[model samples]
Target: MTVKDIATLLDAKIICCEDSLGRELHAACGADMMSDVLAFVKDQSVLLTGLCNPQVIRTAEMMDMVCIVFVRGKLPDENMIELAIERNIPLLSTKHRMFTACGLLYSNGLHGGATN
Candidate 1:
């Protein structure tokens, strides 16, 4: 599915980089810890997290992720949004918790790719 489809599936609000909504994403992973994200995530284009910080954007950028979804209604500050915008990573916020959000995307055909 595409970033736009993930946003719709999670009923998320696009916080930045709306133009990237059309970007296609094959996999997703939800995590609050950046360490786990760095260590275990692989080939994932979308990240769903409850952590609202600039590091989220940085991690997404480093991982070459196409989109980041803030779950549990958590919203990023302007600084984080700016970082995501600079990196051209679409940022979205949704009311669903991390698990629920992940489930929604998975149920809609977005899977978590192989990870070590």
Candidate 2:
């Protein structure tokens, strides 16, 4: 589904990339550990995390992620948002818990980036 659709469904705030709201998101990655995100995520444009840090943005940039969703109402600080803006990654925040958030997206057609 599209970024806008997902944002609407999750009741997330789109902190950036209004233009990219139409971008199609094929998959999602959920992790709070930045290192694990770096190690595991691939070709996954959407990241579901509770960590609100600059390193999160950096990891997304390195992984070519298009958007980041802060789960459980976590919020990114200005520096993290700046990094995301610089990297052109849209940032989103949702009130849903991590597991429920991921599950909602998965049930709605989003898949894990893992290959069979």
Candidate 3:
């Protein structure tokens, strides 16, 4: 799926990189802990998290993630936006709880990341 499809599926707001809505996304992983995301994610993926901090953006950058989805209606503050902007990662937020959001995307064919 593309970023626009994710935005539509989760009712998310695009916070930056509006031009990236056309980018294809192959996988997703939801997490609140940056460490776990760093250790687990393995693909050109998008992150779904409730953490809403600058560190989340940093982690996404380190993992080469293309987008971030903030769950539970959480919004990234200015610092986080700056990080995403600097990293060229698109940011989005959705009101759905993490599980429901992940499930919806997964059911639609977005896998979690590669394990090998």
Best by TM-score: 1
**Residues 1-116 of candidate 2: C-alpha lDDT, one tens digit per residue:** 88898898899988887788888889999988988888777788888899988999999889887788999998888888888788788899999999999999999989997732
Comparison by TM-score, 2 against 3, better one: 3
lDDT string, candidate 3, 1-116, tens digits: 99999999999999998888898999899889988887767884899999987889989998888899999999998888888888889999999999999999999999886863
Sort every candidate by lDDT, greatest first: 1, 3, 2
Badly placed stretches (over 4 Å) of model 3 are none
Quote the positional error of residue 92 for candidate 1 in Å. 0.2
| TM agreement with the true structure for every prediction | 0.98, 0.94, 0.96
- Candidate 1, residues 31-87: lDDT per residue as tens digits? 999999999999899999999888889999999999999999999999998888888
Q: Lowest-scoring 10 consecutive residues by lDDT in candidate 1? A: 107-116
Q: Which stretches in model 2 have alpha-carbon errors above 4 Å?
A: none
Candidate 3: Cα lDDT at 56:
91
lDDT of 1: 0.91
Note the clash tally of each candidate.
0, 0, 0
RMSD of every prediction? 0.6, 1.4, 1.0
